[model samples]
Target: MNAVAHNAQSVINAAGSTLEFLSFTLGKEEYGISIQKVQELRGYDTVTRIANAPEFIKGVVNLRGIIVPIIDMRIKFKLGTPSYDQFTVVVILHLENHVVGMVVDSVSDVITLTPEQIKPPPEMNSALATDYLLGLGTVDERMLILIDIEKLMSGADMGLAERSPA
Candidate 1:
């Protein structure tokens, strides 16, 4: 085969192996949350810090006059202390009955994933608790960590019962 033909074939192979990820940086690690869960992405804006809330609860933002509590994923995962700068962003997520925001370092892009491109997380990868991870996906030669948005947004830690006091 000619050199030009061989180079083109290589490019095709590389493209075929690429997977899509909604990439964002948490601490120093690049993580991927499913694009399906994402409602919108916005630049870092002033947050009305709420009192008596968890430290990770960065507070509420007036998104189009609707209040949304922003959770810092770094703190939620107990990854490390979080520092913010110009690159910080808030990713709004839509759940069953509500919409919440999660803060990440920055958002990269949306990439696609294939079956063979993903693998189950290793045991003891419990930094953020691998139980919440659907799996790990490889896209563009990088690993996109898949997260279960339902599990993260359900407020399972709040221990709020469905029925109120009668």
Candidate 2:
């Protein structure tokens, strides 16, 4: 076989049924989302405040001519008073129609895990709804709360339901 064919086979075998997640921190816990949905990462910056927008909606920022809405997950989850220090970051996500940016405490490295490593999210009563969670990912000593970024961003609480603010 040629070198290119050999390399392709190696990658396919190594990646067998594995999924990648972009891990990030919120408050004191770690969370993750599908890496394929992530467009890019940027440092937290000032946003234009919108009238009647939800508190969690920190407003919007222009990303390459696109008005991308920024949501502070800390505020949405009621973690605590969010602090925008140097470590604060904005995770740019590419949904079906809109490109949204999520403000996270800090971003960690990407994690790769197989289907077996991903366990069902435990039943619990909390600010984070189970419908927004994909599952719990376990990688060695770390536990990542995998979330459905697309669904969460499109939820009613995200100020993108169906009615425009009047």
Candidate 3:
């Protein structure tokens, strides 16, 4: 093969191999979710409260014509009481058959991680459920807790949806 043909093949191979994560903060720690699931970002706004719902489940919001349930990640992770500040934002997620919104302290940016950059989750009993954790992604000196957003959102404890994800 010609040198240019080899380089072109290399670029094509590399382009689709990387996965993107939308990085956000809950407190001091950083977390990431699949960028493919993210629909859009919106500033913190009032949500209609759901009676007798979990504290972490902030409530529901009318996004366009669809009602989306907003879950506060900070509260769910037990980081601390969340304050609706300028930095507070909600990430609209497009899950199977429905839409959900996740609230975080602030959104950093979308980061792409190669397969080599992602390490398997530690084999230790931790506060956060290991099942929902994707792994640790290293970018430069920063470590991001990559989360399986779909699994976490669709878990039995979530109570946000009736039908289980297939």
Candidate 4:
């Protein structure tokens, strides 16, 4: 086989066996979510505060015509003081017929990981509960905490649903 054709075949084979993740950072740690769950990426914008909302619930913003509740993973995980800088981004996710946005320090890139690169998360007490993690993915020298975005968003603590007026 020609060198060029061999390389093309290798690329095609790799793409079919790997899963893609949209990697982002929160504090110094790196995290990733399934790329299929991501609806879009948006710059961090001011959100309207909701009464009686939890601190992690940064509030809601109008995304096109729909309202999206923005959650700060840093606050949700009690990592540290969450800040909004130029690098701050909101990852819009479409889950279970609901749209939500998550704020992260910065979005790095989309990474493809084969099943062999993923490891089951270790059982330990940590800021983030294990239930919210899919597993750990290692790429090169970096480790990505694979977030179960759907479970995290729909959990009771997130309060993603709109509260009806009393």
Candidate 5:
């Protein structure tokens, strides 16, 4: 077989099994979430804080006239106090019939990960338990904490339906 034919077979052998991760940084660590769930990326905008809302919630913002809840991912992950600055961005995610925004320090880029590239969570306990993490991606010298955004930002704890503030 020619070299091209051999390469084609190799590619086919790795089919149906790759996941793309949207990578971003929180503090000094790199993290990733499945790209399929992300809707869009918006610059850091002024948010209207809701009274009697959870602390992790950044607030509500008018996303093109549609009200969307903004969540501080750093707070959700219990990393540290979140700061709003030039690098801060709101990443809109769609999950389970709800559209919400997640705040991140900075966005790196979208990365493709095959099953082989993903690794299990660390045996020791982390600030974030394994339940919140999908897995870990070890690429070169960097470690990407794979986060399940839907599970992390599910409106369940946010009490979204109980209050309507616009």
Candidate 6:
């Protein structure tokens, strides 16, 4: 192949091998989710509480006429008592069949991590189970806990819808 063709192929291969993540902060630690699953990001807002719902479930919100259940990650992960302020954000996720919102402290940025930059998460007793973790992604001096968002949101514990909205 010619030099120019080789360079173009290299670029295409590199892009195909890398994955993009939407990074956000929970407390002092950072976490990431696949960017493809993110529907939108919205500032924290009041949600109508559901009767007899779990505390981790902040309740549901009307998003453009669709009611979306909001789950607070800080509470779910047992990081600490969650405090809401201007910086708090709700990341709307579009899963295979359902749409849900996850509240976080704040969103950092969208980071692209090559396959080589990701490492398997350590197997240790922690608030979050290893099954819910995709791996740990390292970018520069930062280490982000890559979350398996689909698995987490779709689990029976989350009580999310199993079918897409009509």
Ranking the candidates on lDDT from highest down gives 6, 3, 2, 4, 5, 1
RMSD of each: 10.4, 9.2, 8.2, 9.2, 8.6, 8.0
Instruction: Compose the digit string of candidate 1's lDDT tens values, residues 46-133.
Output: 8898788888888888878667878888898788888888899899977655678899988988877765676665556335444456
**Candidate 6, 74-155: lDDT as tens digits:** 9988899999999999999988877889999999999998877877666565564566666778999999988879878877
lDDT per residue as tens, model 5, 55-113: 88878998878789888878876898888889898899877657888899999999887
Best by lDDT: 6
The residue pairs found clashing in candidate 5 are none
Which regions of candidate 4 are displaced past 4 Å?
1-16, 125-128, 161-166
In candidate 3, what are the lDDT values of residues 55-137, reduced to their tens digit?
A: 99999999888888999989998997888999999999998857999999999999998877877676554554667777788
Off by over 4 Å in 3: 1-16, 126-128, 163-166
Lowest lDDT block of 10, candidate 4: 3-12
Instruction: Order the candidate numbers by TM-score, best to worst.
Output: 3, 6, 2, 4, 5, 1
Candidate 4 lDDT over residue span 120-165, tens digit each: 6666655635666667889999999887687677777778644332
How far out, in Å, is residue 39 in model 3?
0.4
lDDT of 4 at 63: 79
Q: What's the residue-level lDDT of 154 in candidate 5?
A: 51
All models: lDDT?
0.71, 0.82, 0.83, 0.81, 0.76, 0.84
lDDT of 5 at 4: 30
Tens digits of per-residue lDDT for model 2 on 39-138? 9999999999999888999999999988888999999999999999999999998886678899999999999988778776665556535677767789
TM-score of candidate 5 relative to the true fold: 0.80
